[model samples]
Target: MKIGIIGSGMVGRAFSIRLAELGHDVLIGTRNPIITLGREEPDSKGIPAWKFWSLHNPEIKLATFQEVADFGDVIINATAGAISIEALSKIEKDSLKDKVILDLALPLSYSPERSPKLIYSNEDSLGEKIQRAFPESKVVKTLNTMSYKVMLYPSLLPRQHNAFISGDSEEAKLIIAKIMEGFGWESKDIIDLGGIITARTTEMYAPLLFQLSKIKGHYNINISVVSK
Candidate 1:
């Protein structure tokens, strides 16, 4: 499977390497290839520049946002929540036609006082916005509530945890669910909360997840749905 992932940051690199290791052709997309490749140092977040990371993993390739979107069988949005739509909008409408968009981004932003909050949550969600923006494509939301490490390596925690997926297209959801399975997520561990609207709750989990991470001093955590 050819997978195109938007964003050349840690999240995108994590998925690119894991998926390529799984025998899938992966391409990571960024805004400016020349500029991104020129940076020798890490960013404000301390993530290594794309050029350095690209050297270690030559199997996975890089391209501009639109180019990767056109090359992929399925497009994964690994971009930050604040600019996900802008990044995706770079792709032409025809390229997105009937394509399954696996969205795992949240609309996170900080206030003037540097307080964390969701740009769109509760009443609306980034998944719903992506669906609306690209009506021709099927958008499925998942994995936004957890860390990228846990996303590809669910077994790292060693427990019966769960991942949530929501989309208007059942077929699209199934496709993404299969990919999640490839990442070592058991079939029973994946929970489908119905249509794309359910992303409201999933994306809304960011604040709580962040709080928990702050308290624990680690981002490695999982959500388990217990039942009788």
Candidate 2:
């Protein structure tokens, strides 16, 4: 599979490297290749510069937002929540048509306050918005509830924790679920929350995730659903 991932952050790099290792063709999409490659400073989260990361990762090529959208058979939205919609706007909607979009973004509205607010209401979510924005594309929201490390490696948590999935198309969800399986998520542990609207439920967990990481001093954690 040829996968184009938007955003060159930790999540994007992790996916690009792992996906390339899985023998898939991978290209990382950014607003500007030169700028993305020229930055020497670490990101706010202290992740190393993309330029530094790219040198060690020659297997994954880089492209503009539009080129990636055109090249990928599957597009992964790994951009920051605040800029996800805007970043995607660079792509022609026609290029996104009928492709499975594995969306791993949360709509976070940051203020000076400690806790950032979720942009969408319970009736709507980033996943639903992406689906509505590009109705022709099949959008599946996954991997947003956890960090890049845990997302690519669920066994890091121990004990059967889960990865939740939400999307309108069963086929698209299956495609994403398969990728999760490749990431070491068991079929039984990958929970389908149903339709894009349920993305609100998963995404709403962001604040808890943030607080939990702060409390635990790590992002290597996850939640499990237990029901009879």
Candidate 3:
């Protein structure tokens, strides 16, 4: 599958590398194309440089937002929640028409002291808002319930974790589920919590993940769904 990932942050870069490793044609969209060139060093976060070195497929090119929207068979929105709409707005509406967008962003807004909080509430979610804005695009919300480290490679961990996907489009959800399975996630491990309305619950997990990251001093944990 030809996949386009917007945002060059940890999540975006991580997914690009993993998907590329899995033999998928991956294109990364970033504000600055130089980052993909690997000319400069990475920040203290240890993400940017690592991704550049780890990418096995040189075919994974850095492209403009519009190029990504046009090039992808499936578009993955990995941008920060506050800027997700802004980023998508820059792309020509027609370019994303009838496309499947796998949304992994959270509705986070930054304040003075706090890190970020969900700008949306229980009544609405980022997924619904994006779907409303791009009615022609099928948006499936998934992979927001865990950290970037666990998003693709979970078997390395001691226990298996669960991920949730929600969207009104059954066809889109099935495609996302198959993609997830390719990335080392098991079918039984992923929960399809009905349509996009359930995205509120999935989005809410972001704040909880933030709190847990603070408590554990790590962002590599996962949420396991265990049946009794």
Best by lDDT: 1
Instruction: Give the per-residue lDDT digits (tens) of candidate 1, residues 1-228.
Output: 999999999899999999999999899999999889889999978998877777899887889999998999899999998999898888898898999999988898876675479997778999999999999999999998889999999998977899999999999999999999999999999999999999998998898998899889998997999989
Q: Give the TM-score of candidate 3.
A: 0.88
The local distance difference test score of each candidate is 0.91, 0.89, 0.85
lDDT of 2 by residue, 1-228 (tens): 889999888889999988888888999998999887889999899998887887899778888999999999899999988889888998899999999999999899887768778888688888888898899999999888888898887878868888889999999999888888888899999888899889889899999999998899988878888999
Could you give candidate 3's per-residue lDDT for residues 75-121 as a string of tens digits?
A: 99999888899888989989999899999999888877996788987
Q: Model 2: what TM-score?
A: 0.95
**TM-scores vs. true structure, each candidate:** 0.97, 0.95, 0.88
Off by over 4 Å in 3: 32-57
RMSD of each: 1.2, 1.3, 2.7
Compute the lDDT for candidate 1.
0.91
Q: Which candidate number would show the highest TM-score if scored against the true structure?
A: 1
Residue 106 shift from truth in candidate 2, angstroms = 0.9
Runs of candidate 1 exceeding 4 Å displacement: 111-115
